[model samples]
Target chain A: SQTIHQWPATLVQPVGSPLSLECTVEGTSNPNLYWYRQAAGRGLQLLFYSVGIGQISSEVPQNLSASRPQDRQFILSSKKLLLSDSGFYLCAARGGPTGTYNEQFFGPGTRLTVL
Target chain B: AQSVTQLDSHVSVSEGTPVLLRCNYSSSYSPSLFWYVQHPNKGLQLLLKYTSAATLVKGINGFEAEFKKSETSFHLTKPSAHMSDAAEYFCVVSDLWGKLQFGAGTQVVVTP
Candidate 1:
């Protein structure tokens, strides 16, 4: 089993403020990490995914960026936050046997509110 | 393209009644379908999955989903609903690269 840890369960930021959300994992190594955003009344949107350290794939071009500094550390950052960026941000990792159709385990999630 | 559609945005059920969440997917090839549950203000938890192997998949907390290839549907059901079963459910389809396509969540309301 994998445990995902997300800090600052909730955040409130002003428009144009910089943003950063951290996600760390334990009980697994080199797991594929992903960042998703769930806007109110909308589905989850895939923002980014990392296969390994320093490798990131952006699913949608937006104001936010993701980085994998360590094997189990994934971070989501934004240079300037917008009101539209307010949403529930989730961090997930693919778990199970590699090269198989595995399910993702999610962290507690961070609720970001941009005013 | 691969995508998933959860038929209902919300469903209300009695505690002792059956539960059903309908989902349909679109893919050119055989897709890996999954059901995930999310509690209020919480993260996601995998309910069950249906790959090419089986049409019926059983998941945690006594939830199950049956995959119908003919209709391209993967619907989740529980024999009897519980208060704890009130949560949002998502229908997902996985691509070859392991990326998942999630459908709009269906919020279940279990009433006593």
Candidate 2:
């Protein structure tokens, strides 16, 4: 079975503060990773996705960026957080082409509150 | 471009009654569709997916959705509504490249 983990389940930061959220997948290799943000009462917004290490695609232009330094590790970072950056952040991993459906498995998510 | 539209933003249903969450989609090419559920404060969970293999797909928690090509709809249904089923449901469509386009989601409220 494969599982995904995210850290700093809940965070409180001030505007202009640095931010980092980590996500890692277990029992899978070279999976496609994605970062999503959901505003209160809004739909999930795709922020970034990575096909492989050092290959990142930004779906939306925002204050945040994503990086996949290792095959199973993905990181979401911000040099300076903005008040609009407060929301629920999610990390997801999808099986490679050889595996089953292209469905994504998500981590527990991190709730960020910018004051 | 691919897109999904969930018909309802909020639906309240009595327990044991049927549940329906309507969704419509548009895609440039043949599309793959999916329904995902998110409990409060939890990550999104894949309830089911339709990948051009089967039109009717059964998912976890006794939920199922049927894809209608002519209508361009993939509506989720459940025989009996449970209290645990109260959550947010998202309709998703993916183009051939596996990029997903998500709907604004519908909130299901189960009443006792």
Top candidate on lDDT is 1
Instruction: For each candidate, give its TM-score against the true structure.
Output: 0.97, 0.97
Q: Which residue pairs in candidate 1 have backbone atoms (N, alpha carbon, C) closer than 3 angstroms, thus clashing? A: none
Provide the fnat value for model 2, as a fraction from 0 to 1: 0.47
Tens-digit lDDT string for candidate 2 (B1-112): 8889999999999999999999999987778899999999999999999988889999999999999999999999999999999999999986554567889999999999
Q: lDDT, candidate 2, residue B81?
A: 100
Model 1 TM-score (2 dp): 0.97
Model 2 reaches an interface RMSD of: 2.6
TM-score of chain B of each: 0.98, 0.97
Chain A agreement with the truth for model 1, given as TM-score:
0.97
Error of 1 at A76 (Å): 0.2
Error of 1 at A29 (Å): 1.5
- Estimate every model's Cα lDDT from 0 to 1: 0.93, 0.92
Interface RMSD of each: 1.4, 2.6
lDDT of 1 by residue, A1-115 (tens): 9999998899999999999999999988888999999998888999999999999999999999999999999999999999999999999998554568877889999999999
